[model samples]
Target: MLIDMSVTPLSADDRQRYARHLALAEIGEAGQQRLAASSALIIGAGGLGSPAALYLAAAGVGRIGLVDYDSVEASNLQRQVLFTHDDIGAGKAEVARARLLALNPRLAVDAHAVRLGPSNALDIFRRYDVVLDGTDRLAVRYLVNDACVLAGKPLVSCAIHRFEGQAMTYIPGRGPCYRCLHPLAGDALVPSCAEAGVLGVLPGVMGTLQATEAMKVLLGVGEPLLGRLLVYDALAMSFQQFSFQRRANCAVCGDNPTITRLEDDGEATMIEEWTPEELAQQLEGARAGSLLLVDVREPHEWAAGRVPGSVHIPLGTLAARATEIPPDRTPVFICAVGGRSMAACRYFAGGGRPAINLAGGVTGWSAVHGPLPRPEGCQS
Candidate 1:
């Protein structure tokens, strides 16, 4: 990407616009110019991508691409700072593209309002100087990393779960790819932001780091996070680093690779929760008699309210007290909304219990059928 440095001659307006960057001795005019010439692709224009795209565009990254097939939901406004309330129901990629261009008219923004899959990942990745993994899904993480490896593009990946987040860079042979760092399908077991919840500002912190790393990779400035993980704990207000190495058998980046081409991992596909109405209908059927309604929310939540006839067994203790759930009755896991219960469902399904996830959980249940009456032994 050295060509980015001399892609275009800086005009007088460019000097005025990037005066701050020009003032930085390290990233003076030439580096800023390189930034103005470089291109980046940010997968998933939500959470991490929100801040990264804004900062990168603000920093004058010359060309930018956004890939996301999702539409803006009202719930997205909490953290996906890229879209406003008015933008809800709009395509995320299109809205993000318009916003980014509005933020920096000089740079060009490409909106791929489509999902990134095996067919398009490599083609799109090949055009960018670097790829930023802002997507939340683990399967996509593997897809992005593998595509980057095959395309020989540098990758900057970040993820936020609840109040904590982590980031790393994969520069092919320079260090471990994502698969090496997280060598297994452990992420399938991890809860998503929808399931675990997140601090509204956490992704901002992590995404900014991604933008910073992208500049470093392009400008060849400071040491990038090539062979290490940057971990951040918001509650503790601390940052930690853990080092890792490229695995000899990374499956995709290893010496004897098995994943030369991208393919869908069935386990990586997230299970869709049943609708609130659908769950209600299921609960009404005679089958509900044979179903065990187990509440997996925290004790405080359980004490506050629960679906009538539901048994309380907090998620943390469920693994240890598994036998408490009756095998005779098909277990139907429920939580505040649906995330924890979905995780529980996955866990049980993996164990061959094959339980059902109460789509919206108690909260969703209440939304569709009004507040539940507090049981005799419960306190709000």
Candidate 2:
């Protein structure tokens, strides 16, 4: 698909604005022109989308769409850098659109403050050339992927944990879908940014990569991440790429195509909440050996009075140490306040492992079980 860059001559403003891009050998005038004609829809306005949107707007993408149902919270400021304390309590998509437009008034930014689900995904995505999945939930990730496949649009997906991140691009026939790599969501608890905690700069790295891939696809300049997965370890400061093949039996994009329609995963809804009383019951069950409790909190948190006999495996380590979890027992996950455990539960449940959430988490556990005992040399 050779782009006719000469058709749309750069305006004086664009030439001055993208002077740096015109200087690059790989992305000269033609690439910049292509970018100016591209349209992209980003699905999250939080951490990943924040950077991705910012970079894309600055790069002169012609049209950008933002979708998010959440409101900015004080907690989101840690990594959702696009929002400010003043923006807290405001809709994420609304705030993001205002900010991006202020940064580049020439670009078109459409902000939709509604949740993107199967009902609206196709209609919302059909308007854009590429869809970027910045959402952190497993079910939503699958929804975005399948929708992209069904819409025949490309998807640039990225996920982040505490110190690690992963990214891949799905170009329908040209590459493998997300299911091809993670065929089954593994039993290991997938830590979330909220539960496992993330360095403020981590999403900046991964989200920027998502933005880069989107721009590359738009400009048709570099090889997109088709059929490849990029994994990054901040602690080790290393990046690795692996080849992934599409699964012939994939339920959605597979040869048989059994899933012609979208079905919401009920487990995703169950993992999102935990009442105080429910949390207490789960903790009691853990104490009596009625349930196998898995603590995916930090080591220091465990040392500071974890449920007795509960095994500690920080969420970041859960993926690499899946064998450590005993398959004979029904696992119940616990995090500081339940968010991370929910993410972990979703990953496990999606992988065919039935796990329960320890509502209220350890914070609630300590309240009912009495103040947690502070381990020696451990700061409470």
Judging by lDDT against the true structure, name the best candidate.
1
- Residue-level lDDT of model 1, residues 77-187, one tens digit each, is 889999999998899999999999899899999999877877788889888999999986555787788899888999999988888999999886688999898875443
Clashing pairs in 1: none
> Which candidate tops TM-score?
1
Which residue pairs clash in candidate 2?
none
> What value does the lDDT take at residue 331 in candidate 2?
70
RMSD of each: 5.0, 6.6
How much lDDT does each candidate structure score?
0.82, 0.79
Model 2, span 1-380: residue lDDT tens: 23234447899988999999999988888878888777899999988999999999999998899999878877789999889999988999989999999999988899988866767888898888888998876567877887887888889999887888999998868878887777644523444435547878899999999999998888776899888999999999999999988889986678987556544444544443445466556556644454567888887667867765577778887677766777776677788877667667776666667777776577767766777666456664
Off by over 4 Å in 1: 1-6, 190-194, 264-380
